[model samples]
Target: MGGFFSKLGLSCGIFCALVARFPLSAQTKQAQNPVIFADVPDLSMIRVGGNYYMSSTTMHMSPGVPIMKSTDLVNWRLVSYAYDTLASNDAMNLANGQSTYGRGSWASSLRFHNGTYYVSTFAQTSGRTHIYFTKNIEKGPWKAVSFKPSYHDHSLFFDDDGRVYLVYGGGKLRLVELTADASGVKPGTTEQVLIENAGAPAGPNTGLPAEGSQLFKIKGKYYLFNIVWPKGGMRTVVVHRADKLTGPYEGRVALQDLGVAQGGLIDTPDGQWYSYLFRDFGAVGRIPYLVPVTWADGWPVLGTGGKVPETLALPASKGLIPGLVASDDFSRRPGAPALPLVWQWNHNPDNALWSLTNRKGYLRLKTGRVDTSFVLARNTLTQRTIGPTCSGATALDVSQLKDGDFAGLALLQKRYGLVGVKRTKDTKSIVMVSAESEKPVEIQRVPLTQNKIYFKAECDFTDRKDVAVFFYSLDGKAWQKIGAPLKMAYTLPHFMGYRFGLFNYASKNAGGYADFDYFTISEQISKE
Candidate 1:
């Protein structure tokens, strides 16, 4: 027995030595800054056992609040969504000349309790607060409950005593109690002010007052996190702590670097803490950043030495491409979904007008109704455009297009750019449209003779230099630049980052259709 044990110990030592000598890439763990270099913002994260789940704001996009899952804090993948359609209305449906472009859903708060998961968000367009709950987080038929009075930038908290509450509001923070089931406000519970001057921690002259509230109870104390932008200053993080849920709280400035604010706290299984926040990175929009957290005399300290670090001790990210945003061949096997979770419609889509099985291995977008412009067009499929730089290409078949049909690839935003085949009564022409101002203008138009063509849009967001260019190809290998360059701007109307979209719309007729063979994405721009 002693000889056998000695041999086992010697083998273990040899294995350790070999592992040290080899040092596999998976064993090398060091994460870089801006953990996810994509436009995933307004984050609310929760850790269950060894897995972490996050819910973020997607504004007017259908399947509104996106839920992402990650085992390590660095890499994440989309798991599910909170709701399919926020509401069946004119604006949400993009009908009657009204659109919910930037006003559907705002910040969301996610929590889990008693084996039930809850995600709450408020929409200014709907003018209400929506709370969705389910037993299964990944595959869920979530049930919803809505109430009047939209809560802005709220946090859903479940107390130890089985009471539920919502801490929310703007410069002057407020609190309200919910029913035990969290369906609505608790009876006889009056809404009251929690902190009179929540933005005072950052300074008195505040421009964007203290908002984006996230509340937590850690070790018998209630801590509230918020973001504030003082006059002539950048976005800052402020924390307010109290001995009780309702009390005279003490406030202080937590993190004031790189405009990386507006998120809450999360901890790992190994007991390390982090603050998941975001920064405004030009046209790519708000990208997530993780700052290490340490407790100092019971207050959580954010960042290292008052600054966001360039790297972290967590595992290295495997990248977001093909996971968060993927190239779709529109091919599926038996009993498979027609569209993947990475794709989202601009708004509530007209499902009957778009299909994958219409033509095998092709996404056929058939026009259901005639519309005036691209923004008003229904059933526009989209994917978030990622950063430093990225490009999306698609092979379009305009053979089935009818007169007055416009179908192609585009970078969809308030100020947009697109390259597509436009059909008229007598001829077919390839046109490039740019909406840098109040109205869209045809920047360039070239007559086309082929039935099939490829279109691509490349976006450059390096160092906040937001620019995009369009290109077209006849043979799919060689590409030609077309149209004026798009000076991409993060406008208030969109309230989100630019997205690669496949759009088909008709101006004079409604029976036209466009077939897309494949959509591909690369992290490199063509000019690079």
Candidate 2:
């Protein structure tokens, strides 16, 4: 009901009284910056009723365009995806050495119209613009329709007169009116350039111009927010305001701290305004940050004193379980999703290859093709590895694995690492492989004697000094450290964070499958 300081003061009061009974843990309840510490980039968010809903880009991953819900804008949980799969081309299917690793879907725009929740995004790989609408946002049977000619970094705006408009484009901004149903642009209604160079002083830079346009109409004035990277400076925020929808507009730099720019404004029910933007923080990918906004001279100014605050309004932290991150047991009910919302495929998944009910209480991953590398392996399940440190462990039932099948836990990227079981025609062994700079390197290997081998990958992204270490267990209680450390990276080639992935690929043969009993993630400090 109050700010973080007030909540902390109250907790301290209760702590003093309970000191004689129990000891308080060391983790603090302070709300920190980079509200979400994972790779939730190109964010588009909206507030509905009592909840804040956010949509983010997941690129080539199946079940793309993740929609997360948060009550306090800091503690977000994945709710649904706009599409189960992009399903447009072979690249989306990871076929023929072609993959949509970094080019499927990018920044999304989320909005609530009347009673339906709408999420719109364009995929560069698909060359299409998709519009999804649902009456229920959380659990949705979203009706989807797509059209040719993709719109880049666009915002979906519903005008007061019930007209639909798409505010999109590069430095020379354009607004195209849509049909009454919002299915497509009105025929013969040519686009209008809304703003020129967004009124920049040095004009738009050719290398990194003004893009990611989000439009808003507040209190009879039209506002456009965009991220502009000047030729020699850091990422900047430019806000253009016009009294009419088609402007005649003037603009200014609104917020520009720590490269946190390119997002629109949202006001709470109680009238508190905040800007939800993201910052590029090295190999962990672009992390989202929420900045408080204040109205000055009828214009929204971002950040306090033009500086990013370390601690903002604190929301209740429920420690990333059953919410942002989950430890799956692979048990499905009568009519639930085959996998939890927290899990996504590395690219488009082979729907028939993995199952939860195939073997009760276990996840069965069957290989459909013979692939030499993990990057080309389809159906490698993945989830974001949160910072400062977390360990992802899985109990692998390798008794049924075929020869040439590699099953284990992975920290997946263009350059990645894995601690998994490699089964041959007659033998099984545990091994570690990593890719630091050029390509994947075999760091270490250990011969295994048991069928149920446990693999764990501990990732540390604290302060962006990203690194990962591998471990293995035979009894599930005693752990042995193995493999050389991995320098986790956020490379633009992959355009994603280091994710804890469950990968099983075939090399020498196909039809080899592995059953994973469970995957567990917990906070841990590296023994190093």
Query: What is the lDDT of every predicted structure here?
Result: 0.93, 0.85
C-alpha lDDT of residue 156 in model 1: 93
- For each candidate in turn, the TM-score is 0.96, 0.93
lDDT (Cα, tens digit) per residue for candidate 2, span 1-528? 579889999999987878746644333465778787778888888988789999998998888999999887778899999999877577888788888777898888998888999998998898888898899999898999888779999999999999998998888889998886778888888899888676384355534677998888999999989988877678888899999999898898888789888788988888999998988887677888888999989999899999888877656366666677899998888888788999999887888898888889998899888887888888899998886678899997888778889988988888899889999788898999988874877788888888898888888888888888889999998888898888887887788988889988898887878899999998875565
Candidate 1, 127-208: lDDT as tens digits: 9999999999999989999998899999999999999999989999999999999999899999999999899988889999
Model 1 lDDT, residue 142, Cα: 95
Query: Which 10-residue window of candidate 2 scores lowest in summed lDDT?
Result: 20-29
Instruction: Tell me each candidate's RMSD, in Å, in order.
Output: 4.2, 5.3
**Model 2 regions lying over 4 Å from their true place:** 1-30, 199-207
Question: Quick one: best TM-score, which candidate?
Answer: 1
Could you tally the backbone clashes for each prediction?
0, 1
lDDT of 2 at 214: 89
Q: Model 2, residue 153: displacement in angstroms?
A: 0.5
